[model samples]
Target chain A: MLFALRVAFRYLTANRVQSGLLIGGVALSVIVFVFMTALIRGLALFLTVQTTGQIAHVEMEPPRRIAEVMGPDARFAAQPISTFQRQQIRNWQLMVDQAEQLDHVVAVVPEVNGNGFLVRGTAVAPIALQGIDPSQIDAIIPLSKSIIDGSADLSTGGLLIGAELAEDLGLRAGVPVILRSDRGIERLIPVTGIFRIGLSNVDRRVAYLSIAVARPLLALPNGVTSVSIKLDDPALAPLIAEQLKRQLPLKVTAWQEKNRNLETALESQGRTGNFIQAFALIAIMISIASALLLTSVRRRGEIGIMRSFGISRGFVASVFVFQGVIIGLAGSLIGSALGYRLCLFLSEGITGPDGGPLLPIAPAEGGYVLVIVLTVVGSAISAILPAQAAARLDPVEAIQQ
Target chain B: MTLLKAEGITKSFRTGDIDTLVLKGVNLVLEPGEMVALSGPSGSGKSTLLNILGLLMQPSDGALSFMDKPMSGLTDKQLSAIRNTHYGFVFQFHHLLPDFTAMENVAFPAAAPAGGISAEIRDRAKMLLGRVDLTDRIDFAAMRLSGGQKQRVAIARALMNKPELVLADEPTGSLDRENSARVMALLREINHEDRTSFLISTHDPEIAKCCDRQINVVDGRIA
Candidate 1:
């Protein structure tokens, strides 16, 4: 095997131009595969991280279709959780206490969600209202840094509106606004804070209020719609959810499962990665096949002589296979390194259609290396036909010409 | 005792509707340390007979034995092993790999069984090249050598494994008289020194006269 490798190396070195071209072909394919896969994955990752960072990990609500919650025009719905169902569901305090006892649970917050018409002296506009605990809101959702104006504090009978919503309403800090719930009852609240998340859906029509004020305005008797929990490690949420299901009577879901659409998008990105990688491998195989075929034809007489020297057909075949593997590996390594750098350069420049910067694309380095190794092996296997052809040549006929 | 023997050997090739018989009812035996020359006209099956005896081709209807072992129904791999270990061949053309140096070309057969060329095999190839008086040209590419020098390298390659039987098919056919004589002298010296048996096929009577024994082939049959 060592002797065969030496010969193969010498052959390749002697034909540097051919070897370079073959390796370059393999490298180009690898680069294309890695770059395409990383781009799609990076986009998905950015969107997911933005969405999850803003929303609570787990959202508990009455079993309602997404269409209903999002409203007829796919806008925020005006209705709050019914008073009776809210009473029957476990209280925010009780659920929090129960969740804290679980191994990985860190914190929990109960929230009430509804839509209200904000009127500042005949300047009326609808806004999606979230009622949250002043102390626990930050734990469930990262709201402090998300504040566009005023504060995220819910104790001051104040309200926080999205930046766009606030702009449209012509309201600012220390301004009083009348909020009329779906029941037509109204209460005067001060605009203490505002936020702009740069997402059209959130910034155009969203507001936040304290649970104390929102409960009375929505005609609910100290009732909250959902209990959201935070965990020490988000990945362990599924196991914690199973435990929660066993302990709590209500339905439980992990954050990952709750956002099934995003998860599906992530999974599709993974499939795209696999497909691109397979395409690259196929390209490498083609190059290997061509290289081996050419090598075999050029070395026909040598192959005949080797066979005449008692070298088995299998050994002769192995020599070519080894050559293929060496070429594939060399190409893949160089290509992958080039691809990684290319991905890094592309990540900085890529942006969403909405003008948001795309996330930096960085896949596990070890995983990339594994993929290239597999490609080299696959290429060697693909060279089998050519190798066998070279090996089975008749010594007399081969040397005749 | 016969070192190599073939009995009732027959070989045929089919081209379109015609089947041409290249060898018919040919019987021959080669003793250890003997040098036999086969002289024949073109298409007389001298090379075909050499190929069969060298184990590069199988006789259509015959039995062959090497070192008293029968050679019927043997696998291609088995034939190749016997060829590698027991027989060496020098063709009419040098057939040295162009990419390899003369020494490397000579080392090829010895390198084959080992699956690669080692430093020791390289040294042996160099030594063999030196024996053929090509020490200065050993490092030169086979393609760069003169026709006679290339043939001498081919002869050295043929003797790399110290095989008992060496088949030479018009080994000097491509050379000028001076180079041809030089190549023939090298083959003679190797044959005499190593006691290696040789069966040479050639059209040149001058080359044939140099061998210890001579056989004439006419129309694929010993005449």
Candidate 2:
């Protein structure tokens, strides 16, 4: 086996142009695969960071219902939490408190969420209004750092508005703004701050108010739609979720499950990445196949001589396969290095619409290494057909040439 | 006892709609250490007969025995094993592996075993290269050698397995007159010194004249 490998090594080295072309082709494929996967993963990470930075590690809401209540002209009826529903909501909060007592949990906060319209001197836009505790908001969301214009104080009926939302409303810091809930409940509150997070969903359509003011505006007392929790370590989130499920009185969900749309989008991105990787692998395989076929044809006379001297067909096949594996490994190493550098360049240059860094790309991760290795192995396997054909050649016919 | 025997050997090939008979009812015997020459014009099936005798091809109908063992019903793998252990072949083109050195090419057959090239095999290869008067050129690549030296390396490779039978198919056909004479003389010398039997196919009458026995093949029949 060692002798066969030696001969194969010499054979490939002697054909410098052919070997170089094959290696280059394989390396190009591997680099493309690694780069595309990294891009998709980076996009997913960007979105996750944006969403998680606003909300806590987990959020709970009422289960979805598929019903439309038509009024005078097909207007949907409002689905408000009842007195009994408020008790159920309190029970859920009790569960969140229990979860905070777990070993990994750091804190938990409850918030009421509802859709409302904000108006500043006749300029009006819809917004997702979240009612949070002034003292506990920092523990759960760390929103104080994101404040741009003013503080995140929720006292004395003061509200926080996104930068874009504030601009659209024509409201300055400490200016009074009127907000109306869907149930026609109206309140006049002063804008405490204007903040920008560079996310369209957050900056354009979000407003923050105190939980005490939101309770009467949404026509619910001591009621909240969800309880969000913060963990001491992000990696222990799944374990904490399981512990909460066992301890909490009401149903509990992890952030990944509560936001199924984001999770599904991330999963689809991964699947698309896998498809791109497969395509790159196929390209490498085709290159290896063509290279091995040409090598086998060129070495026909040598193969015949070996056969006549008692070398088995299997041994002959292994020599070409070994050559392919060596080429693939070398190409993958080169491609991975190139891909990592390309990722760094892209991350540094590409920017978000707000002129912030677009994708947060780290160095080559374990996942990138795994993808390159798989591509090399796949290319080696694809060379088998050509090797078998070379091995099965007739010695007499081969030598006749 | 005769070292090799063939009775009623027949072979055919099919190309498209035509079946071509290359050998028919050929009977021959080779005693141990005997040197025989097969001579014929082109299209006379001398090469086909040599191929069948060398176990590189199978006769459509024949009864063959080597060292008292029947060869008629052997599988390809079994036949290959027997050929590797007991026979060596030399082709007209030399067919040396271009990537290998003369010494490495000569030791190729012995390197086929699972444990890889042993010290004894390397020593034997060096000794064979020395016998062919190519000790100095043993480290040279096969492509770098002269035509005569390349053929001599081919001869050394054939003797690597220490086979009982050495089959040559127009071994000197591609060489100049000087190299052709040298290769033929070397084959004759090896036969005389090692007592190894030889069956060679050649179109050159001069080469046939040097063999101990000559068999003429005409139109797929031994005449």
Candidate 3:
């Protein structure tokens, strides 16, 4: 093998220009592979972070309760289900503890969720009220960072409303507004803060309050309505949601289930990335194979002489194979380094109007080891045809020619 | 025991729908430590017979043996191994690997099989190069050498494995008269010193006379 490698190296070095050009071609293809991989992965990551940042990775709510019909007689079986009864998680703290014990669970915040109307001076607007611990105001939706008025202090019966809701109801910091819950309960709460999260649903229709103030107002004096879970990796939401469902009797929902369009877009992007990567590999392989085949043909007489001296066909074939390996190894190494540098350069220099990287190219996610291995293995496989051609050359016929 | 033997060897090539017999049924024997020449005109089958005897080509029908071991039953790999270990070849064009140095070319047959050019292989190549009077040119690239020097390197390469028989197919045919004489002298000196056999295939009568004896081929038959 060493002898074949030596021969292969010598053959490549003998024609420096040709070998250089071939290696450069392969390197260019590898650059394409690495760039596309990093870009797609980076885009997916950015989208996931942007979406999951404003929502709970997993949510648990009380299951529906249907009253069963009980009959003392054989033919009497009519039951009426009440519609005014509130559905609330009675033991939400226990469910929160169980969810917190699960792997990847970073934060679990129990909430008193309800629908109400924010009214101020005859300007009434519907709002989704989310009641949580004021200390963990940023546990799920990062409401603290998005606060544009007053403070996130929801203690002393204060409410945190969205900017659009405040605008609609003519409310602002340290102002009192009337909140009427669906349970027919009413309270005059002072607005503690106004937050704008850039999402229409959150900025226009949602309000935050302290869980203590919300329990009495929503008619849930001791139990919360739901539990919102945050995780270290949002992608693990579905798996954690399944485990949570099995561990508790609550209805568990992963964020992905609620945002099917995002998942679909990400999947389609990944498939497109795979196609581009495949084409890059194919181009590299075809270039190497065709170039090495030409080399085989050019050195026919030398190969014939080697065979005449009783060199094994395997040895001859391995020379070409080793050449492919050398070229692939060199090109991929150069390309990976360049690709990473290019990503870093682009990320640092290219910015959008918001001062963030325009493309969100993650240099660290370029799949360096994977691309190198694939290029090298693919190059070796591509060389097989030319290697076989060189190995099968008739020494007598070749020498005579 | 005979070093090599061939009985009723025949070879034919087919073009389109026609088959042309290149070698008729022929018999020959080569003893150890003997130099012989195969002299024939163009299309006289000398090169074909040499290729068959050297194990580079298989005869259509033949019974061949080396050191009394039957050759017909062996696989291609086995035949290649036998050739690498027991036979050597010097071609008309020198056929040196142009990218390699003289020493590398000399050590190729042995080094390639052993996986690398070891210290021992290197020393043997140097010694062979010295024997061919190319010691000063051992490190020179094959292409950089003169025709005579290249042919000398070729002769040294053939002796790299210390084979019992060296097949020279018009080995000095492409060289000038002076270089040809020098190459022939080197071959003769090696044969005499190592007790190695030589089978020189040539069209030059003068070159044939330099060998111990000559076997002429006419119309694919030994004459």
The candidates score, on chain A by TM-score, as follows 0.84, 0.81, 0.91
Query: Fnat for model 1?
Result: 0.74
lDDT of 1 by residue, B32-87 (tens): 99999999999999989888888888898989999988998899878878887788
Choose 1 or 3, whichever is better by lDDT. 3
Question: How high a TM-score does candidate 1 get?
Answer: 0.89
Best by TM-score: 3
lDDT, candidate 1, A1-401, per-residue tens: 77677777777787899999988988888787777666666666666666666665654544433332332453454553333332324365777688778786777777777777998876898878778778775786676787867887878889878788788888887888899987578988899888776777777777778888888877766667777777766767788878877777666778898778988888887787778778878878987898889889988887776776567787788778888888888888888888888877655567767565455465433246665878688878977988889888887777764
Consecutive 10-residue window with the lowest summed lDDT within model 2 chain A: A79-88
Scored against the native two-chain complex, candidate 3 gets a DockQ of 0.80
Q: In candidate 1, which residue pairs get closer than 3 Å at backbone N, Cα or C atoms, i.e. clash?
A: A3-B116
Off by over 4 Å in 3: A68-84, A93-104, A120-123, A166-176, A188-190, A236-249
Question: Candidate 2, B73: how far from true, in Å?
Answer: 1.8
Q: Using DockQ as the measure, which candidate wins?
A: 3
Query: How does each model score on TM-score?
Result: 0.89, 0.88, 0.93
- Candidate 1 Cα outliers beyond 4 Å, as residue runs: A60-84, A88-91, A97-107, A114-116, A120-128, A182-185, A218-223, A231-236, A348-360, A363-367, B118-123, B137-141
lDDT of 1 at B213: 90
lDDT of candidate 2 over A25-114, digit per residue (tens) = 887887787788777777777777766666667555444444433334434545533232322264556666666677867777788778
